[model samples]
Target chain A: MLNKVVIFGVGLIGGSFARSLRKAGAVREIVGVGRSATSMARAKELGIIDAIGVSGAAADGALPLADALHGADLVLLAAPVAQTEAILASIAPHLQAGTVVTDAGSTKSDVVASARRALGSKVAQFVPGHPIAGRETNGPDAAIDNLYVGKKVVLTALAENSETDVERVAAAWRACDAIIHRLTPEEHDKVFAAVSHLPHLLAYALVDDIARKPHADLLFQYAASGFRDFTRIAGSSPEMWRDISLANQPALLAELDAYMAQLTVLRAQLAANDGAGLEQVYSNAQHARHQWITAIEAAETPPSPDKAD
Target chain B: MLNKVVIFGVGLIGGSFARSLRKAGAVREIVGVGRSATSMARAKELGIIDAIGVSGAAADGALPLADALHGADLVLLAAPVAQTEAILASIAPHLQAGTVVTDAGSTKSDVVASARRALGSKVAQFVPGHPIAGRETNGPDAAIDNLYVGKKVVLTALAENSETDVERVAAAWRACDAIIHRLTPEEHDKVFAAVSHLPHLLAYALVDDIARKPHADLLFQYAASGFRDFTRIAGSSPEMWRDISLANQPALLAELDAYMAQLTVLRAQLAANDGAGLEQVYSNAQHARHQWITAIEAAETPPSPDKAD
Candidate 1:
């Protein structure tokens, strides 16, 4: 079991990690470090963390990061992507030699680079990872112990990371009931840019386009389940999406350009009144979508354990 | 109560309408008419229809449209948009003078025009309509009795329609507990093109792009809830969407162009690393989305029922 784990941002992802570790009895003495006192207090009251620690220096009512990280076994920089470097820089000096650091950032390559810049040689202890489990909700109260159960958590291992340290990180995730996959940091970023980042951008853009129209209220009134499901991701936090979009720019922009090309082809077909061509593109998409959904359902299904029953 | 109704397509929307009318005891002797005998037989077995009628002519052991339309109060063309002209043309000769014909096509302007071209003076008895309820699932087996409860259904009344005929159509929808809105056919087409048609096209394009890649399996495996929500519409029927895209070409094309312009702005922001600009767009979208969803929720909420409870 891990002892004395410190979490830099005790919001949804970090708070859920703390709760999961606690539920599994896999960690002892969880401490939260963040800039917000009210959020930390809520996390404390919710028992998501055992202590509230201030970030920079010692203070009257809070435990400083120096003291919090003194005996820590792990540190998770679960804050926004833009803050990765700064959080790492502050935590690196006091990090115990055996302490392992990781992150729950959506994009990996940028996080990996930030770790290298801030932690210097200590970057070996930082195993960059992303949990592919997300809801449109946020904050500590939204956290739950089983958030990662049956979900995929990706670890983009660095060459500098020792095998032992990487294994320790994997073991911690396993304790939370997450299935882990390994990929190079660049590969992880590209995959997510297509699957996650591009979809969000598309949803946000669609919503903004409709909302800016003079007849928006009338349009929204007529929108049915299809529009609701299609724009569901547009309800996600803007600041968070902004940081993700900017951090994964190259990969995301490439995916966006490809998607535009696809739309362009579709527009041409529409302009030409080519029902057959539109059907071809739609058929391909519908077929692949069906295959993917079926695969996911199969993977999520449990084995027949009660044949007798 | 209405007597002797005919439904041309015994699928999700058609079946749902038949079921709802039957459930409310608002119609007598619902008859199913379609090209697929198997589907019509299934509708007969499911009790969604009382009689199976042949569309084109008298057939072996089947009721012909000439017999089915005798003294029929209504004929609802709950079929694909592309079939509007042909169905109306086929049924026009057999249509009783008192019969009020309506449609459940997603697009309205084309359906209205098709009705006018086929029905001539009978166009006065043909009321153009669009029930804004849809599901990805189809066929007789997917029918439900309460499908339109509290959902919006738009009736685009023609100048040729008598006030009494329009009222009769409105009464039928009210019997199914659907809220009725009246819009001109042009307004209905434009509003839906922005809200429903555009989103569906966007979803299909995004899925086709990612699924055609060599690493499609890997990308699909990593797709989480956000991706699932965003592309849910991509799972819709290809033939149905193709018909919709072609039938509503003008309005949908305008929407598609405006959407592309929005995407171009987003791509430039990404290329320039403009986080603030992206955040501004995202924040505006998130705010409007929040407002729209909240308003929908409020509208859907029933009057402070159970103050005593």
Candidate 2:
């Protein structure tokens, strides 16, 4: 029954959140807060929000940072990770007494700590979240109206975040067509380091490695769809990935060390010309990939639909 | 027009060559020799060859070794690298004098040396060739008639392979719908190590690394298309990849070392929390990727079609 939701930094994630809310008929009014005139204009043009709430150049452009929160029941801090803490700091005093504050930042422990410090007694209403859906493409333009149509959204709750607060966060995500999952902030950072952050790091590193070769131009000539696919995430926003990587460095470095250990084993097998061992490893990896594919397919299918088919 | 062509070890590559020839209308007859009746039968069933020259089952459903050379005016060695030297030894005595003998082995310099030692003066017609196209799926059943279409085929020749012999190899590939690219055997190995072989190794390693994570099951749930694309090559036949990795070890190891250097810089950047530095590296990689995409697109566009528009 949250009638008014205020979204800070209405770029891709924020704009998509707006779309999902509109599509699901969850929030009656969406107030977007941003400094960029172009982004604000584009959000309005795309009908990503009912009207620009605060900082609006026009009556509907945007509300002032403080005014944007007046009477709002929910707040989404969907800004980039580097800005999340600062934005939370700016709006803390203005936030209504009981408004549930949540976020979509990639890393969470720091964000949660910052939210706790900034919101004080109101920390019980703050939840941190991340939706594991995005493209190499970025910004509001790249935001598909249905981006979260069937994706997983993780909400990390502190002990101070009451059951009521967590439920509200889950309900907001559900309205966006996202299936909600809960994880501890530490667990969220570690898992994402393995999956999201590490993968992008490897992609950027591999692409950069190949680009340095003397015959890099010709080598890329022979590169096919497989290479393209492996490195596609290398095209993701560097600044954003850079922030995410540093924010989650401890887990990422640990993951990298583990990866190098595996690579060392593979390298030794190749050096020894151990095709049998190589075959065993590759076969197992391939088998695991197929199993992973099957698991994803199973997860995507609803329980009844899965059995019915 | 070369009406008759002999293909040795006609599994996926050989079967594909047969079909590519049939579709291009370049060669009049294709003589296929393989170890498995299943493979030969399936190749024939798929219209890959007008006739199977020799067929019998080996341990893994591969064709019998010796019969692969019968009546091939231009014999193509498509045997596994381990078997290439032995296959050449058997074929050398029976190969018709003045017949152009070439190979489709992935690693070339070793095979070329073996061909010379086996056939002596008759090595003039022997050209080493490797077509850089394949799928994760393998055997005759996985062979696509158009697999080589719009793909690059590298030809590595020794001084003994006369211009006429090289031209004939080039002509055969042209007829098979391959874009011909020439390189020294050493050059071929190094370039593919950076672009092809290294990527495969990384793909296998990354999948293994991620698989070791606790929530590995859920980790993949967040894997978007980019992850799937990056790891597609990981699904390749372990046996084949193992052989390729081993046969091309020196070059691959060298490329791996180079890749590790790039990774080190990236890791340092992450550890140092240098967001802008990371962004620059990512942006450079992105630029390089775009350049590659543009080159590929230009190569794929038919020259006359643009004017026809």
Candidate 3:
């Protein structure tokens, strides 16, 4: 059992993790940490965490960094990607010798590097992770115990990480009913950049283009369910996405180039009025999407038992 | 009251229109026409129409073209964009003088041109329209009376179109509880290219690109709800979208260029690791989407009374 777990950035991801661990009875206490005392208090009031703490400095019944980590067995860094380094630095001196550290950042390479810089020798205990589950709504109020029940938790364990520590972090997630998958930081970043990061950027750009047009209101008025679904991700938190885009810049740029090439070919076909070419492209896409939906639905039907490392 | 209505395509759009008009008691009889006799029979059996007719050649108890339009007071051409010209030619000789003809083609300019070529002087009775409403599902089985309720129906009336013909078509759409909006054919193509056509193309292209990747299945396995929503339009009818992309080639190409420009600028920001620039774009999109959702929710709160011409 985890004696004490401290979660930094106590919003959706961190708070939900706390609730999940509590429901699993895997942890004795979850100490919520954040910059906002009001929000942390709300998290505590909502029973998302057993206590509250402030990351930078203590205030409003919050424990200081060293005190909060005095007896902690695990540290979950769930802050914005841009703040990962700073958060790691703040808590590095306070972490116990055998404590395990993991993160819920969307991008993993940068977070792993941050851990190496901040924790030095103790970085061996850091097993960088990303929980692939979320909703558009955020904050402690959006936290729920079942958020990760059937979701995938990707762990990019560095060469420096001990097998024991990796297994410890995996066990924590498994207890919360998350299926764990392993990948190198590079592979994880490249895969997610193509699938997740690129789509979010395209959604944001499309919505921004329409929003800035002279006929913005009229365009939105005539925009139907397709437009609504296509731009739904544009409604996500800008700061979070901005941090992720910058954090995974190289992989994201490669994805953007690939997407642009595909779009360029499509534009040429449209300009040439190539009906056969257009149909081939759309037909291939529809076929692939229909297949993927079938596969995904099947995968979701029965959650695989806790995966072996 | 309309004496008789004939729908040439008899699928989602045409079948839904017939059902709505029947529910409103606005027409005495509805004739369903299509290439598939079985589908037309199903539409009739489902009560979407009172009779069935076949396009191309008559068979399997299908009525001939002349017989289908024998007394059609209003003819709705809901065929695919590629078939607009041929459908118009088939019905031209059968249409009585002053009989109103309208089309549900996605691209207005091409349909208008087809009317000019096929109908000759009868082009004056043709009113080109596009109802901005549909589900991914098609066929008569998917038709619903409420599909067009609160939807926007854009009409692009050619100079040859008489004012009386325009009012007649608008009244028919209003009877189905659709709000009527008028625009020049050029304007309609440009607006729809930006808001609808480009998004569909991007979705199709993105899905195809991912499907061609080495880790396509893995990428899809981890794809979340955002991916689902963004790619929903990619599941649309390929032949229909292919026709639309080619029919509105010039305008679609222009919109594609504009979108490429926007994406290019965003790519530059990512390459430069400009967090502020990325944040600015995402923030603008999120704000615009939130505003549009609010406006749309308010607009959908109450169905505006049947619009006056």
Candidate 4:
């Protein structure tokens, strides 16, 4: 069992990891560190973390982080991707030898790059991971011990990292009953840009489009289940999505170009009243969606009862 | 206290109307007319209809339409919108003098125009309607007595329609527990094109884009809950959406153009790394979406445990 674990940003992601590790008997104590003092106190009260460590990090921090990081078995950076670099920089000076570090950021390449820039020679201690689980809810109160259960935890191993460090990170996630997958950081960013990041941008665009219309109120009155589901992701944190969109800009832009091309073709068909063409496109989508949903159902892994993590 | 009701194309919309009418003790006998003999037979077996009537409309129809229309109090055309003109034409010669006609089409202006062309002077008896109910599930088996409970049903009364005929159509839906809203055919088309048609087109475009990519299988494998909800509408009937898209082409095209413009601005912001602009758009979307969801929840009108109807 890990003697102590240090978690930065004890929101849903960090708190859940602390709770899951405790549930699995893999960690004996968890100390939380984050910008939100209220949430860290809540995390401690709920036993999600054993103590509140630091308000921030390093020379400018509210408290000394070394007291918490001295012998910590692992340090998890679960903050927004925008903070990854600074958090890594802050904790790098205090990390004990053999203390593994990993992150649960959505964009892998950016986080890997942040680790490299912050840790310098100690970057080998960082094992980059993206835990694909339910992030539909937030706050310390929303954290659940089973957040990563049956979820896919992707580990994008760096060449500088030893195999033992990677295995230790994978084993900790496995303790929470997670299945592990490996991908290069570049591949992870591209794949997620297509599926996750692009959708958020599209959803945000659609919502903003309607919200700004003169008849928006009237139109919203008639919007139903379909619109609700389509724009659900638009309700995500704007800053978080903004960071992700920029962090994965190249891949995301390529995705946007591809999607815009599809929409342009579809618009041409509609403008020409080409029923056959529209039906063909719709048919392909329906068939593919049916096949995908069927495979998902067959796997018996119901989508997280939650969204985007 | 209608003695008989004749329904054309008795699928979920027609079947639900028939069931709801019976549940409210508003109709005594129901006759179903459709191209699918199997489905019509199933409708009869399920008691969603009292009898199977004609197979199709006019001279090419499989059975006599006279018997079903002779004493009918109302005629509801619930088939795909593409069949609207033909269905109205066929029923015109046989409809009883006081028999009210209505439809459950997605697009209204096109249906209103079809009514005027087919029914001529008798168009006064044709009160066009669009039932906004749960259509996620289809066919007779999926019909529920409360399918329209607490839902909004839009009635687009034509200038030629008599006040009594319009009221009768509204009353029929009221009996099925739907709230009634009135709009001109043009207004209905424009509003729905924004809320419904545009989202379906967006969803289909997204799915088709991803499904056609070389790494599509890999991308889909990692797709989670957010992707699933965003593309759920892509699972709808291609024929229905194609017809809706064509029927409301002008308004839908306008909506599409507006969306494309929004996307262009978003792309420029991303290209320029304008974090402030990106966050502003995302914030607007999130605020609107949250407000919309909160209002919807406050109203306590749960989305049709079903989708698109």
Task: Name the lDDT value of residue B143 in candidate 4.
Answer: 83
Each model's TM-score, in the order given?
A: 0.96, 0.92, 0.95, 0.94
Candidate 1, clashing residue pairs?
Answer: none
DockQ for the candidate 1 complex?
A: 0.88
lDDT of 4 at B225: 97
| Chain A TM-score relative to the true structure, per candidate | 0.95, 0.91, 0.94, 0.92
**Chain A, model 3: TM:** 0.94
How many Å off is the CA of A1 in candidate 1? Answer: 1.8
Better of 3 and 4 by lDDT: 4
Best by TM-score: 1
lDDT of 1 at A28: 82
True C-alpha contacts between chains kept, each model in order: 0.91, 0.61, 0.85, 0.90
Sorting all predicted structures by TM-score, with the top scorer first, yields 1, 3, 4, 2
Q: Candidate 4: TM-score? A: 0.94
Better of 2 and 3 by TM-score: 3
Writing each residue's lDDT as its tens digit, candidate 2 over A157-268 gives: 8888789888988998898788998889988888888767787888888887778767787788777777887787887877778788888888888887788778788878
Model 3 chain A worst lDDT run, 10 consecutive residues? A300-309
Q: What C-alpha lDDT, on a 0 to 100 scale, does residue A245 get in candidate 1?
A: 95
What is the overall TM-score of model 1 with all chains considered together? 0.96
Compose the digit string of candidate 3's lDDT tens values, residues A1-309: 899999987787888899999999999988988877888889999998888877676776788888888888889988777788898888888888878889999998888888889989888878899999975667889888889998999999999888999998999999889999999999999999988999999999999998898988878877878999999999999998998898899999999999999999988888777889899999999999999888888877776677534
Q: Write down the worst ten-residue block by lDDT for model 1 chain A.
A: A300-309
In candidate 3, position B28 carries an lDDT of: 98
